[model samples]
Target: MIIDCHNHVLATALPPGHDRFVREMRAPGHRRAGRLPAYRPATDEDWVGLEGDLDPIDPGTLVDDHVSAGVDRATVLAVAPSTYTAYGERGTIDLGRVTDVDGPLEVAKSNDYIASLTRRHPELIGMSAVNPKFRGVEWARDELTRAVGELGLQGLKLYPMYDHYAPADRDLAFPIYERAVELGIGVMVHMGTSSAKDTVLDYGRPGALDEVARHFPDLPLLVCHAGFPWVDECLAMVARHDNTYLDISMFATKSTQRQLYEFLLRARQLGCPLSRICWGTDYPGGGKPAVLLPKLTLVNDVADPGAPISRLDVANMVGGNWARFAGLTDWSEQETLEQLEAWEPRWRDS
Candidate 1:
């Protein structure tokens, strides 16, 4: 099936005034101010007019959007930015200050929220979020067990960029990785630049995952965003490591169509198996799939002059490969549509 391996259930409410962080990230040019020239915000008008449609951010709407867009399943990923700036060693926490404390609790709440949603929505899979530096290694291990064993999460999401640490920093994260290996869950590392204020760009180098993959060996390692500007390095990593996979999340966009298509073509030319690629919309950050799916489909179907990519290659890149990698069973987009014919009569023709 078309399983969106990376998505977020945009929380409608944040702890007090924490919405600014989300807003800053979503604000036009804020994410690429120092990077892309077209996105560089030069004035108040440039920033203010950039505020696009303000759609309601909730799980139900997200699911409806997915179903309407022909995606059968989605993995709702949780993010805990507070973990990096508040509860971890990358920064100091001010207990008495606003937006300064309760990183662990915030993460727990986010995980619980996803768990609750996934419990009700069979199409949704919840991936747990945990900071390896929370309290200590022992605490981190126990928390991971609680998240998987108790919370029923099926995947793990890690963002070392926010914490300003390399993905291969085993001293602080090895224990959590070990637990994830034991639980047979994949670990998705956010690679490339982040709009978060305290984020460190260098920490997101896709090569940082090399040591982590080497140490884990058997654990499923997903480098999200195809490592963006470091696409070549990420492709090399996937080629070198048997267990490493890259997800085309935010890259599967209209603006990035050519870049992403060329990367996929080069990846195949470089002998990186299409099976090592996964489809992810990075929903919310990727806007609606309706806008992206068409562009993504074009990338999958079109060819460069006479260098046409096969239909099987396109099929695998969209969903087949993800099912094989995620170990999902009896999954098929067509099968899901058939089931919908019997269940939701109105959706039969859709």
Candidate 2:
């Protein structure tokens, strides 16, 4: 089964506005503007507004798109960017402003919306979002418990960079992790690469999750985007911790095909189990499964690869890994992973 592990079905009636790629280009130090000349926005009018598409597609249409694209399932999530992004940009929030803030109510409503989708559609696996800093950790924990125990959400997703907080903040993040562990649900963290306006890059580093991984050794922790631009650290973390996994969300595009393929080869060369890594498209955010799916097998075309990447390797990335992470399959019974363990890297000696 082909599954996209990261996606958002936007709220149709009251979908939130977004900070787009162009706005990130407009930001003072966005690297894409400097590194990739073709992407640099050339007009003053492009900066007129920070918000982009409202992304309001009905939940049914999103499912149909997945089905028509040959994707068997997708993991859907709720993120309240409007609730926290703008307010958290400066990296500081007044304690007085959080308790009675309207953000938490919106956050709850969004979680409920995802919960509804999960109940109605078997194809969509749902996850709830929480910003412990935007609302108190206690309240966030309570909501997480309710979301999992009652609403039937499969996991919890945290957006630290967008919300301006470090992932390892013991006081703010630890409690939420503890709660997720108790609930027996996996946690997906938005680590690595944020093109959004006013995001703090330091907060998105995957290394921050190291301490969290150690604290909760048995909890399944997924580092979203595979910490691109710092993928070595991400691969190292995944190699080091049995509990850590990766969701390679945004790197499967035409622009990044080679970079991602090379990284996976090196990761395999170093013995990082590919079974622990899952493919994610960041759909509704950015990705076309129909386009990106074929790119995953580009590795096999390497004529002199040390050990040719098999179709199973691509399958693991496409859906098998995620099936295990989402509890649809037994992680212990994964037989092909043994074949991956014996595989070598690139054939050429550099």
Candidate 3:
């Protein structure tokens, strides 16, 4: 089955007195706590980008689009900027303010809406967001438990750099990690570039994850964006650690295509297993399937040529691999070919 492992959904509820939609885009870091940036919400541009005359956020629309694209499933995370916003020099600006809807009930309501969506579409798996800095370890653990055990979420999504915490800093995130491991919940951490204005570049590197990996060797960890600027370091980390894996999110842009190709070739030469790498669209931010498909095709074309990776591989990268990593097994693989027989004809025609 094919899966888009990294996509986000917006909360349906708007804060009281707040516009149902956001018009003015706030600067990267402006507010902390609940004053986080809400999803731009669906726009005509987003629909056009998806190659659909209508918005794709609806379950039926999304499912139909995925099936047409040869994807069988997708995993979604809630879009909460505060979860990733960091401290800026001007003051403490955070995406958390976006979640600031008067109280925790609002956050729960928003999360429940996404969870309800997952229930409506079995193909869509859910991931709940948690900001350890905002809620201490105990509260974070309780909320995560509710999200997973009660809400049936597959895992927890975290933005350490944006939350002003270092992935490797045990004092900051170890409690949360410990709770996740105890609860058997997978943790996907944002690695690489900070989306925040006051981000510290060094804190987001793959190496920063080493301490966390060492501390919780059994915890399933996914480094999104393949740690971008440090792709090699990410590959190396995956090569050395059994529990570490990388996701190809927001890396299919034109500017990074050649670098990605080179990195894949070199990593293969270095004996990195293809299974360690997974696909992700980064959706809303990376553009939709229509724009991302060719880029994904480009990477597969240069890496495997003839056989390349199958659409199933794409699915695996998007969701399946993460499922296995998270300890879920409700997926099936497609037929394998001894060799890629369709490459020459496909490449020539394309």
Candidate 4:
């Protein structure tokens, strides 16, 4: 089976006014959450190309495309942003995100949409989202419980930095993590820097998840984006913690296949189990299958010089790892080389 461990159905993935709010928040002299921008925006051009990013395409069609592309299964996460905090600062700020001002209703709606998608397509796995800071830890915990028990979501998706909360905060986030452990579901956390201008960079680091991994050993932590720019640190944490895994969403693409191969090679050298690494494309928003799928096989070409990443490694990276990690007992190794040999020539250079 070919499985995509990270993806988003844009229709319900983003809250209303999210794009407009973020644009307004980045205006000159607007007060941001953590520190000033690490790299401040120069002009509106910096935020260009985001118009299509928030478009609400049909989730069913999205799944259909994946099916046509030979992806047997894909996991979609609910996008739930936290309420903007009330702090003393002499600067301007707008809505920032619809969820930033509203309570947990949007989160529920998002999860409901995701649950519906999963129900419609058994090939899709749903992950409910929660922001412990804005809605209160108790509410977040209860929401996750409801999502798993009633909504049938298989996991939790968290945006610690974009939502302005310390991911490692024992009091704030631990309760939610505990709920996942009790519910027997995995957690997908957005690690590394966020493109959102209002996000708290201090909270976005992959190292903070180290504390979470150590605390909740039973909770499967899938660090999204491979913690890019901080790849070494992220891989080191995966090496240190058996419960931690990394997903190459934005990190792997046709243009960056060589870089991803090098990272995988480094992973082997670091003693990080290749089985814990999963293939993912942040479809509809970040990376998509058309731009990333071919690279999944292309990386093998670059995995050389020593203990290279084998075809088996490529298979595990694309499907087996996620199936095993997510307890997907039904997923089998159906995409054998013999079955895909016809497309092998198409996945190569002209």
Candidate 5:
């Protein structure tokens, strides 16, 4: 029942001519989406060290790692960078040049790949991504319908900052939101600073989701990363919106865990239900399971006796709450713990 609510799979291959395109985007003094400080060119050693490092590996290996880390389920998301930028900017701009301006098709392929992965691995739930800015409204709607309806993806992910659209842009994004409501699936919105160079930072602020939540109060919405630096604002949004959730992805470090625990304590004082919070690693960004598990387990160790957070809170944050939120019916906290203990002998008896 440990449902990891957010993570991404690497593209199987770099798009043709993307190397040349990135080089051009990296011309002196010009910021580019792909130019994050953490960027490193892939190498043979990276490929060989897949189990220990960030190198892309097969889905089976991803599942094995999750099991070793005591996770029972994980949600994988698709990303479409071309949807984040217009022809002049970083994300979509370079892709357009490389793909002969057919960048949207690449996005479709990514979504298709994730869908296929989910089909092969039921333990891995798939979330489909579409850029309303890259494709027209009708196309966006159709792609979403295809992903959820035909492809059977359980949710949708929208990256307004990477895709260069404001989350509050009702005119541009409402149609997709409307469709999500009709489909009975959740939507995950990326909120907070994106690694993409020069992307619209303001667009990702947690408050931006307030309008949409107000507009579609019934649609399940997730604010990924708990909106990072804007954590207080994120808490407010979750407090006001019944259907909104905050996931602790990318907050797997020990220091950030303390920040999150404090935030959760404050949220409880404000009468916000603990159920609205969920766990996520943002995977590759949060590092591998071995690196992330101890950071996550720290929440369990530090649950002060009289604090709002309890040992039970740690259990729910890791998986129980997510199962209920994600509409999973087969999960049981006791059963999950037993199964995980059986799988990972290192997990101490609870």
Candidate 6:
């Protein structure tokens, strides 16, 4: 079964008037302009405001897209509402002016909603999002417990850069990490380019993750975005730490994809296992599966060089690796193989 370990689905409950602020913040010439080229504003009727006759952002459509992509399962993450907030140019929140102490609570609610979707569709898994700074240690601990113990979330998503903090700043984040370790929930952190004004490039580097990994050697941690711009460092860190893994999200560009294949080859040459790497389309940010196909083809072509990548390898990226990493093995590889075989003729026909 194929599983996308990292993909985001935006919640429809974005506060009224928030979308305009997010669009303006991302607009060209804006102080918080994101690194990527600006996106056209999403219209009200558009599916998640994306440009394309794509599947809707709801669960049924998401499942359909996965099946179409030959993916049997996917780990869906919630993009934080604060990821859209304009906190000056530095992405820092002015805590004093904020009236909402429910930022973390709202995030938990979104996670629960996604978890419910996953429960309905056994193929989908939910990854919870948390802002350590806003949620703080205690609330973060409780939320992590609830997400795992109650909601059955498979993992946790963090955007330290969006929270105006560095991943290595344990002074403020250690407690949350401690709780995560205690709870045994895997943590997936954003570790590449910034889409917010307050994102500090330095904070997103893979080197900053070393201390955290060292501190929680038992916890499985994934650096999302393949640690772009610092792919080499990320590969090095993954090689050095047994608990670390890399998720290839937002790595659809041909040039970047080639670089990633080279890095994977280098890691293999150094005796690192390919199982340590997983695939993530970053969804919304990555556009549709059709737009991402070329890049996926490149990775597949290079990984095998001659024959196509085995269904197992594809399943590894789609969701198997994540399931293995998360210690959940309810899904059977044999069943996955059966599904793949059932679909193989269709894929060849296409």
TM-score of each: 0.81, 0.78, 0.72, 0.82, 0.79, 0.76
Indicate whether candidate 2 or candidate 3 has the larger TM-score.
Answer: 2
**Index of the highest-lDDT prediction:** 4
- How far does residue 221 in candidate 5 sit from its true spot (Å)? 0.4
True-structure RMSD for candidate 4: 6.5
Candidate 1 TM-score, true structure as reference? 0.81
Per-candidate local distance difference test: 0.68, 0.68, 0.61, 0.71, 0.68, 0.63
Q: Ranking under TM-score, best-scoring first?
A: 4, 1, 5, 2, 6, 3
Off by over 4 Å in 3: 11-64, 79-105, 108-110, 198-200, 254-259, 297-300, 303-320, 335-350
Give the Cα error of residue 305 in candidate 1, in Å. Answer: 4.1
- Can you tell me which runs of candidate 4 are displaced by over 4 Å? 11-16, 21-51, 85-107, 305-307, 334-342
Candidate 6 Cα deviation (angstroms), residue 349: 4.7
In model 6, which runs have C-alpha deviations exceeding 4 angstroms?
12-17, 20-56, 80-108, 253-260, 290-315, 334-345, 348-350
Give the per-residue lDDT of model 2 (tens digit) for 1-350.
Answer: 67789986753122222323333433543234453235665353544343334334456766886766556788897673235444322211111221222443343465677776777788888888877866688888998888788888888888888777789998888999999889888899989877565678998888999999999998899998888777888888888888889987775552466666677777887667888888877775465666555556445654245766666767688778777766666333244344323222311110
For model 6, where is the 10-residue window of minimal lDDT? 88-97
By TM-score, the better pick of 1 and 6 is 1
lDDT (tens digit, per residue) of candidate 1 on 279-318: 7888887767665654555564445787765555655666
The superposed Cα distance between candidate 3 and the true structure at residue 235, in angstroms, equals 1.3
Candidate 4 structure quality by residue, lDDT tens digits, 16-86: 44545434433332323322343664455654544553455456667887776667788987776444532
Q: State the weakest 10-residue window (summed lDDT) of model 5.
A: 90-99
Lowest lDDT 10-residue stretch of candidate 3: 86-95
Error of 4 at 268 (Å): 1.2
